[model samples]
Target chain A: MAKKDDSPDGLKLDRRNFFKTTGLAGLAESIAAPAEAAAQSTPAAVGPGDVPVRLNVNGRQIDLMIEPRVTLLDALRTRANLTGNKKGCDRGACGACTMIVDGRPVYSCSTLAIEVQGKQIRNVDGLATGDRLHPVQQAFCEKDALMCGFCTPGFIMASVALLEKNPNATPEQIKKGLDGNICRCGTFSRIFEAVSSVKGGQRG
Target chain B: MKAFAYINPANEKEAVAALSPQVEQSMPLGGGQDLLARMKDYVTQPERLVNVKTALESTVTPVGGGLRIGAAMKMADVAEHPEILRMYPAISAAAIEVGTPQIRNQATVGGNLNQRPRCWYYRNEEFVCFKKGGDRCFSPQGENQFHAILGAGPSFIVHPSSLAVPMLAYGATFRLAGPKGERLVPAANYFTLPRQSLRMENVLAPDELLTHVILPAPGNVKSGHYEVRYKASHDWPIAFATVLIAMNGSVVKEAKVVMGAVAPVPWRSAEAEQALVGKSITEATAAAAAEAAMKNARPLSQNGYKVDVAKTAVKRAILRAAGIQTA
Candidate 1:
């Protein structure tokens, strides 16, 4: 409990008192008047310790106490009980952890949960409306676009985001759109067919 | 990733003020695609990370007959922007070729320019290479297949930036904001070689933020970007070239030839530019310029194949810039 290496409070407390005495803390409070000024507005830094994090995942609000080191994918899969997206490479290379944030597909494993607090997040869990599968999901099942089923959720999410944006995508564009996700079973040809065969457009 | 505090600053002034003097203690998070990956690998352990996405510039503006693009703008927007596609096609071409659709949507302009080398020795915790503050680099005697061919020394890791090639070819300048003030650094001097900077890749300090890239207007020049990759989809290039040639009718008046994924920095070849200065950009002239570009390339033991790949990229880049049919 006494060792400075044990807790971040050792350095945090010193920095807090130093800023308070110098009146620099007042300067930080006066100018930063934005909604994102939650942690910085207060004199104390948030954590290596647990702080409150409110996430909006798949149209449902889930609140939890998470450390800053927890990624968006980990927070969604572990605490929120939304485990549709798989973690393939954990790095940004593999797209198994892909999720749509504000109309763009992003690598959720590399993104911090705290940074995406105010953005609209949509994952594989939000896609299907009960028995009626999403167009991309229905296409995947019909065309057998998946073999292992591990990468299916991420692939479905990526395809949904792509087709919703460019519904009239050509074969080349479809190939480039879903290039992030890798089916180790090498079912790319069938995946391409599933994506391109969707008639009309996906607005969502 | 190590335990740290995260802060989303509302402005660049707040971002730099919150940074620690020690570079390793505090870092400015751009896209988090590069920094977070490094953090997860334990290659970088910062005590605090300041999110600069909303704080930095995020809009593109026309300035002094040139374009000033915000550093926080995503690569997806930059690749599809109509003005960028019309005015600077090479820049759009390079941006479009970056990772995947998902990566382009997430990666930022500043993040792409300031990314670290993709050397396996640097990423692995087992090998304490020069980039990790160790005494020696392990690439020279170790597995050297993807190592550098042109710039080889204490560290042989090629710079992992594709946008920097076209930025240097267009003679763009990066606006860097720091605690002191703001300063504009030329793209030619922005990236550093291993001997110049051992522990880091670029000249930016820990507290500084690259806000915008100001590109000068391309005056009657043809630009082309070409990259030779092992995979057609979502992979790092073996070698890439960006060639900008100012042509007077049919003869080349000026040329700027830069290559990426071949050295510790975005390598600009003066020999290739000199070879094409006074000649018409025909098939033979483009081949001669490409030959001159790879003349000084001394490959490592396992990377001799990269020399031919890089030479083909240079020749094809010249031919494409001249609007010639290149197969």
Candidate 2:
């Protein structure tokens, strides 16, 4: 048994204090080991490097260590665990990773994660209450706007953005506005119906 | 994806200073809707990524003579801008007709103007086309259905800038910031032919950043752009035309005809302009101008239809500009 250094007036020598002094140093060193290892592993400053980013995603402040290569889709799915944004084509062609960035609908798959640090990020996960679904989500379900449902979230988010921007959007505008998102299941007619119905329903 | 560094400068000077060294291996990111996708696809792997989105210096404002649209001004904002709608309606229309609403919302005007071509061979990683420093142009012998039928040489990829066509017609100029300072280049002369330089598109140097697009006062010219595409959605067109006409009582005084998706760069038809100038824009004249525009078209085996498409597009554009409905 190790002796405790009890120099205080009334404090008594205890085994707990003796063990804590020695073991606490080891625990602290172990806790700090990862950070030191990370710092040592990274290359020195040749140019500007990956910055620590703090973003407010879906009303939650998230701190993440992201490289310059990390896209918004990567940050959402990997770091924030918001997998509702599916990585479809991973290109700008398919809008599977659509999310409301600063009240505007954007393809998260093509957007850099660090670019959206301070902007408000709203994913499909933020579209529902405890037991109730959003009107667009409900409309998509009722209209059978999705077959595989892989592209459903993106379509739904795009619809919400469109309806919010132009509630009375004409059929031509609707077709033009939703031109970016692609559904491989060939449920575009139903998706259009769902969005158009929302426009009419909102006006009503 | 290879590991890369990131930078978010507060101002242009800091950003420029940060970008002093790695111009060749570094790239500035705007909305990242296009650049990041290209990076992820391994088409471009920059060692350092400069994030200039937060640099508030890039903003569109009504300036002295006309509108000074910032380089990072999103395409959606430009399309919906009231002043642009009033002055350059064709530019707004072209902006609206880009990829998609989401893309327009995120993609900057400068980025749109600076975007790479959408040719299938150019985009595909497997095929080593002429644009990628390969031996032969795949579109010549391979599937050249969407290839250019005019102003094409060593390469056949079409210019992808919709706003650029309208900008050229509107007499817009680009303001670029570089290692030296700010310099202006006419939008019409910004795009270079692949024959001139197969590896590059615009006249921008390695360290130069497109800062703003300066649209001259509308003056007395009536300009309009009309694109005829295969798909109404997010696809580039087969042929499009931008017509800027200066009329003197129903008779054309000066005409500028710029065609998009017709060549390696935006094809400006001086012959079409010459045919229209000092002449009334009648049905016969419109047809004549269209014929003059497509006279030099040398179509490939698959893209012979583009000649007719370009002619029809030119005719329709002239008619639309003249307020004469053909449909």
Candidate 3:
């Protein structure tokens, strides 16, 4: 791992050296004047630093103080105590970190928590009610669509988004829609069946 | 990933002000897909990150006869947009071929265009390649089955943008916003070669933001993109080609053929385009054009098969653009 010298002094020095080398010191100075004034005017505002971030998730507003580098996946799982989303390949090659953001399924691992503030974030944990599962979730359970169950949450989110986007999605559409999520147990046939079965509002 | 200061600029000017034009100290964050991955791998250690997603324009608006796609627009939205799908089908095809649905929902057009080459040698910290400010290109002497086959020299890394080839074939232009001012660059001159700059892939300065991709209206041109990948789903293509031909009744009036994953940049074959001019697209004509596309390919020892694969992609793209069924 790289030793992060991200201190304010270190960052300031880096910027100064960069400006010196790039011959942008004049422009940088002009821009920094107002920024420094704004910083002085604020009341202990921490930005470009770890601070409180509010997220409207599912239906509730959750607050967490985390560094800007923290991804939405980490913030959801570790900070908010919502662990339904799994981190498969953190670099976005895998879809295990899929979550619904404002009706669209995105790789939570790749999304920064600071970027999605005030957006309606949804995860697999929010799919089930007191005694009933979401229609898509119920479909998966009846069809035995998952074996390992690690990739199920992400698959469920993607399926929900797909169904919401195209209510009467064809088999080809289902295949293309769920192409992002990968089931390690090779349960694609059952998963497709489940998604297709629910497309017509079929119940278990 | 190392802890870094994140600045959320409310506008494009603030974002550009937060960025350093010459040095790589600060980087503009798009979807944070590519930047975060590199940060996690310790490949890039930027002291600060400027979040430009919120600052830049994220809407795809119609301008003149063409459509202007915001650099911050998600890949999924861009691929599914009605105008993009109807007018520029090749761009949508190429965008949909990128990684997967989740990735598409999160990735942005600017990020896709500026993504670093996924050369394993350059990605791995153990192997210091020329692209990574090292002495020599390890792919030239190391495992290079997935490396470039056409453009080889000091560096053999191929451009990894799926949308670039199609955009180039459509004669798209890019809009860049910087502290100085906003400027337009043609798609043809957007991507740079290894000889031009070893550290950067495109001509985007560090302080400049790739704001918009302006696609001129596709007038009388039928375009198609064909990609041949080892894995049909999420894997990058082994070779892909985007062909745009202006048809006059049954004959080709003008042609633009660009191949991806074959060179350092989007490899445009003037010879292939010349062969398609003033001729109908037949199996024989398509094959001849395809052959001309890769006639000067200098493949590495392990990537010799890519020459044929690229030619087949070119042939299929031409046939598809002409509405011919090769199967």
DockQ of 2: 0.26
Q: List candidate 1 segments past 4 Å from native.
A: A1-44, A202-204
Candidate 3 chain B has its poorest 10 consecutive residues by lDDT at B125-134
TM-score of 1: 0.92
Q: In candidate 2, what are the lDDT values of residues A99-179, reduced to their tens digit?
A: 999899999888877667678999998888877888888888888899999999898888888888888778887887788
Each prediction's whole-model lDDT (CA): 0.84, 0.77, 0.84
TM-score of chain A of 3: 0.77
Question: Lowest summed lDDT over 10 consecutive residues: which window, candidate 3 chain A?
Answer: A36-45
C-alpha positional error of residue B12 in candidate 3 after TM-score superposition, expressed in Å: 1.2
TM-score of chain A of each: 0.78, 0.74, 0.77
Interface RMSD of each: 5.4, 15.1, 4.5
Model 3, position A119: C-alpha lDDT score: 85
TM-score of each: 0.92, 0.88, 0.90
Candidate closer to the true structure by lDDT (higher is better), 2 or 3: 3
Model 3, position B62: C-alpha lDDT score: 89
lDDT of 1 by residue, B208-325 (tens): 8899999998778898889999898688899999999998877999999999889999999999999999899888999899899999998988999998999899999999999987
